[model samples]
Target: MPPVPAAVDPDTLTSLLDGRWAGLRADIRAEMAAAPYRDPIDLSVEEHRSRVFDQLTALAANDRAGLGFDKAYGGGSDIGGSVVSFEMLGFGDLSLMVKAGVQWGLFGGAVQLLGTAPHHERYLRRIRDLDLLGCFAMTEHGHGSDVQHLRTTATYDPDSGEFVVHTPDRGATKEYIGNAARDGRVAVVFAQLTTQGETRGVHAFVVPIRDDAGAPAPGVTIEDCGPKAGLNGVDNGRLSFDQVRIPREALLNRFGDVAPDGTYSSPIEGDARRFFTMLGTLIRGRVSVGGSAGSATKRALALAVRYAELRRQFATPDGEEVVILDYLGHQRKLLPALATSYALHFAQEELVAALHDITDDAPEQEQRELESRAAGLKVANTWHATAAIQAAREACGGAGYLAENLLPGLKADTDVFTTFEGDNTVLLQLVAKGLLTEYKDAFQNLSPLATVRFAAERVLGAVAERTSARKVVDRLTDGDDREALFDRDWQLKLFEDREQHVLGGVADRLRKAAQDPFGVFNAAQDHVLRAGRVHVDRLVLEAFVRAIARCTDPDAKALLERVCDLYALANIEADRAWFLEHGRLSTGRSKAVIAAVNTLCGELRPHARTLVDAFAIPEQYLAAPMLS
Candidate 1:
């Protein structure tokens, strides 16, 4: 927006992170080598899921496995390092990545984050060792994203110091739970907590599903979900508890606790806050998934780039079928996504770091902030991964569609990303709500109009800054001055303001919907979905802008400029309506934006390989050669 920073180089960001993935490369490669190969899409619903469980077991068996879990409990080391290893799994296979995620990220992380020290010591090591495979049983058949109203319950009893778990109906049973059938010996089940006739909201519990010999535990009935559109290597299932009873200690007593005397107390006040805090622990796992999605995008883009470099098409009179990478259209389709891979990688590093700091005994407020960051990054990265992988697949023409080529398979696995770990659309709505809440609290008003008004004032300030500033960055750099270009604070302001604007727009839309319940629900769907996407896009752009600012190399800076240019233009063009509606850009400026995108595509053509090369995904990891 502010004369796309001239000096910021693309390679600068790559070097800034200093190859954090280097140390994990050997383990990543070895895991890829040792990992079993399974065609999830080719199996029967039952066999497919069975294979998924087996794969999970196989991954857990590795000594270097569970790197992301608690080191004291049979894990490798740091959660950050584990994430690095998980991401690289995409290079070998997507199903393995996904099945492993359900196992460790969801199932194991639930125990790690939601469970207390006692629960962790008692069951976590077994989970890590695969002696007790488990499922994260939260989503019910009827309620997927709406977890608050789940129909299952855990009622405390002083008679035997036990609580009864029951799923009153079909919808109440947990559904679409990974690793639930055939393999799981335990489950981290979430059910309403009721003590002394007072019903608290959703709480997590550790429930044993099988005996030592792997037989179904008493009163728990598990049914395999059979099959679905994607993620076949996951043994998804539904479970119903018929008056199932377990010790009162089964509840994960980290955030809240229940004594043997049936007294319940939580460090957090209010039913709503307690529920949210428990759910807030999920942010780390979501952030971890975002990192994995980033890897998926890289793998897919690498495949496309390699194929494009070698696959020739119609050429000029000079007589050569032009390499697809030579085509401006292909560059337009692929290079920005390649740049996004960079953005996602750096942002993920930041998110992981933020998570580490907040989780390391920081105050509650800091933890909440980390959760928000995790939410924003998770929403942005997953949506980008799904879209990028699909685009990369199509960019390869036919080969991408073949299973052998991997893109098609990768796409299938990533497709579920939009739905699981909180639906992309739903997640953005939550982010919008979070932003609106902050706006109201910061400004001392909850009204949507008040929030919008405050945001409008902020925008005015930004516009004034744009008008009166000394243009500190403009004087700093001219043509391809990547460093000074990235140094401009205006770009960061643009991102901040853009997010606020979109969030305000969503609030306004929600308010309008309140006027008529039915009409608003129907109309708000598309409007809210759009706002959510815009917010995520702004995040991606902000990350790209920040990374570009950190670059020092001249050539990488130039290439990064091309990348940033394409990313900015492409995003703005997609949201032409917002620009026009808000008077941010005239029709002529919008046309120029489109033209700028085209120019960027041409400028970045030769460097497409160079840009992706910076992702540093080895050829062996890709299982294919560049320009082959």
Candidate 2:
């Protein structure tokens, strides 16, 4: 284990974790501390919704809502700052965090990014100011993950110069639309557009769902989805249209448009390509979801760690009670997860900066890479939150299960994250598809057979070539397995080698699908998913490595190095069976990895409070009564 200072300053660590948006993070933290906010544990569903809506309105009043919008529309025009602000909200009520994301990051973002100049001029300011609370109505009963084939239609009637949006069947109804049950006055509805009798795939349109009197528009039907497992404060509902008439200008025509004469035109040649390009421009929502999930995980750990420190159990021979955190079992549960949280925090910071810096005119490959990273990280962060928060709750035992302690709410609220923005399973496949195709027409085809065939034809050679290169590099290792376990270069190579081998193996299995693509791909589905998981694992480790290099303070740097080691070694230990199976590690070396993880846990147990305190969560969010 590397030497860490006896006591490192948490504030110094905070500065490094804050990254490019430190000022904004500090301001938001201060604002949250001063705000009149309370956890909604005891509030009724309607009452909680009311409280969250008020908070959203107050955020808009302070101009915080305009941070990501264009300055031309009275916004601050700071993209990354806006995301950081949303992440900070996760320390408090998650319902508010989700509500704010729907308002600014999704609904407003669609208007700004997918809509044309006229749409922006008409809606962006209103959306920013909360004068027009809206729903992002994309998900439907039949098409959640497979959005390219949505059944809802927006048919152009040139005779009336209007588009009639309709739900042809029950499957076309928009399900779980945020704000639709009560608050939303309009919706950015996604539906298949038809012009001159030619149906042209999925496109977004600005459609009014409610009138000034708070009644449904003439042809719009809205039904509350009722209380959910969590996030009751969000008024999710089902929306269906019965020949709702919207003007020709309602189309958000950034990539595709229809003329008054019923002529359809698009800069992109194919429907799939254009729809995906539109989706790529709106990746901020996914990025924000992942960041918010990380924040929630940090809050859970802080609560659990604080309780562990104060709650004493069992007596030692010296006649003093041992702090629960001293137990190897408790440390094993929380410290590795804490270290992983640190790693994810750095990776998220990198992803946000990339999203903020990429130009609109950048190559398609860059955009695809950015989208892939966003998808990959969202899968990582949300799944981590689900697992880590549950562990935190269990770590605190009975006290953690109480609603007032906040872990219960955090667990329930974040549960939907794995499926809402994109199903984690589907998103992982998307990541794998991008890898298999090298970003060439990857997003254009998501069907199983197409992806399998594509990988067989295009990716097999690349995988083989990378495998050969890895072999040459492997022969150069120093052969001292025990000492090399802590070497950063060795860890990097092991992760890289594992990814190449898994990916190549998948390609080989897929190459035999010449007879029955779907059946072959289905049998090898687990392998396909593994390729995606390992690829993301490598990216996250690299991001953590890069972040450590950027640290300037010696004490903080030294502490972070130890934390990163725990992260790397713990992950390897968890997947040791794979290494053993592949002959990458001997039984003795594999046992050593476990011993190293245990040693790191004991070494880090004393500094648990300092490590979590570096997150600098608002004291209000961590105020569980048991901790007192």
Candidate 3:
């Protein structure tokens, strides 16, 4: 958006892109450089499982698996760095990312965060070193997004000092659990806690799924989930515990505990709140999935951009064929996506940093904010990854259809990212709920007169700042000067106004419909989701802007501003109807937004390869033929 006083610097940008990442990336890159990690073939599910498992084993043997755990448990205690390195696996294979996510991020994380000292002392180091393999069994056959409704039960026996874990019915079976099918011998299973003939609530317990020799433990029935649409290398399985008993101490009691006398106690008194808080402690999986999906999108763009440069198509009048990339249509298809990838990279990095800080020592309120932010970004980034990867697949033409190209694999694998890391729809609702809760709280602590005044002020502010305000921005800038329209303040105002309008409007309608909370909320789900999307869109642009401001390299700074502007305008263009109907943009300005996007695409086209090269995916890991 700002004036560029210097040329683009790809080297500086790439180096800066890799800055601050811990050495785990170097180790991952080195491992990927090896033949086993670089295979591009389409192996069968069985073969694929073995490959991913062995890869996890190798990462563990080299002391690379526990970078995020507490230092007391042999981890580096670098939560953000661990996630940063984990996402790099996207450069290699989706299966590896999912497998490692299951092994470390989910299963081990449950023990480390939910379980108290004894559980950590006994299991953390072993999990870190791959001395033990475990599954995170939370989702059930009947309830995927609603974990509180999961039917698995852990009934306490005071006399015996043991808990009998059971799947009361087929619906209680844990579904799509990574590591359960073939590799896992232990599981951190989420089940309703029952004592003194009364159900307490859903709690996590360390239960043995299989014996040392890999056979199902007594009363534990495990079934393979079978081949999937993609990422078949992950041996997802279903588990049902038929009255399997374990020591009472097997309960992960960091958040809740039961006494030998059959009394239930928890740090959090409320059942529903306690369930969510316990689960929130294990939210790292969502963060890592989002980052990993972002990496996949970057790799896809790199592969496609490189291919477009090399694979020439229709010839000119002079009989020499032109590179497909030179065509406006092709650039339109890929360049906007490249811009989005850059925006997400910055947003995800910011999220990692924030998560690291908040998870380390922040208070409960900040942790709640972290949960909403993580949920929103994870949904937004994964959705972007799916769209970007699909566009990339089409951009590569028939070559993308080949499994070895990895775009298809990336699509299939990352598609589930939208659903698995808390289904995107549910996650957005969580974000919306957080926003609404905050709005409610703001008005709660004031006097009636103050509340009414606050309410009226907010109302008047929204009305003034709504779509009508776009005309003000337009009048301030020279409509013909694309640079003027792309101003950072202009972009921020536009995005922020859009979010405010959507959120404020939704808040009003929901307040009016508050009589039936669940029904009314369900009726307004679409608007609530829109509110969530706009908020995340605004955050992404803000991060991109902030990152550019921090850049010392002038050329890189200027070039990155264009990337940021492209991201902003492209989003505005995507939802132009809303902006136009709401009066946020005049017809001419809306078209200008599209025009600006094309202009940035053409300007950035020359640096496409270098931009993707900045992602620094090793050639071995990105084994697509086009890259070669």
| Candidate 3 residue lDDT tens string, 7-114 | 565667876676567355666676677655555365888999998888888778755589888999999888888788778887777888888888899999899889
Query: What TM-score would each prediction reach against the true structure?
Result: 0.86, 0.95, 0.95
lDDT of 3 at 279: 78
- Lowest summed lDDT window (length 10), candidate 2: 469-478
State in Å the error of residue 328, model 1: 1.9
For candidate 1, lDDT tens digit of each residue in 227-276? 66677666677888999998988888887888888899998899998898
Candidate 2 residue runs with Cα over 4 Å from true position:
439-482
lDDT head-to-head 1 vs 3, winner = 3
So what's the TM-score on candidate 1?
A: 0.86
| lDDT scores in order | 0.71, 0.89, 0.84
Q: In candidate 2, residue 14 scores what lDDT?
A: 95
Candidate 2, residue 465: lDDT: 54
For residues 1-628, write the lDDT of model 2, one tens digit per residue.
4587888999999999999999889989999888776789999999999998988888989877989999999898989988988898888888999899999998999999988889888999999999999999999999999999999999999999999999999999999999999899999999999999899999999999999999999999999999999999999999999999999999999899888998999989998899899889988989999999999999999999999999999899999999999999999999999999999999999999999999999999899999999999999999999999999999999999999889999999999999988999989888887887743353355579877776666566675655654553353345665466787887888888788778877766765566687999899999988898989999999999999999999888888888998999999998989987876666777887888889889988878999999999989888899899
Which pairs of residues clash in candidate 2, taking residues 3 or more apart in a chain or in different chains? Answer: none
| Clash totals, every prediction | 10, 0, 0
Number of the candidate with higher lDDT, 1 or 2: 2
The alpha-carbon lDDT assigned to residue 98 of candidate 1 equals 68
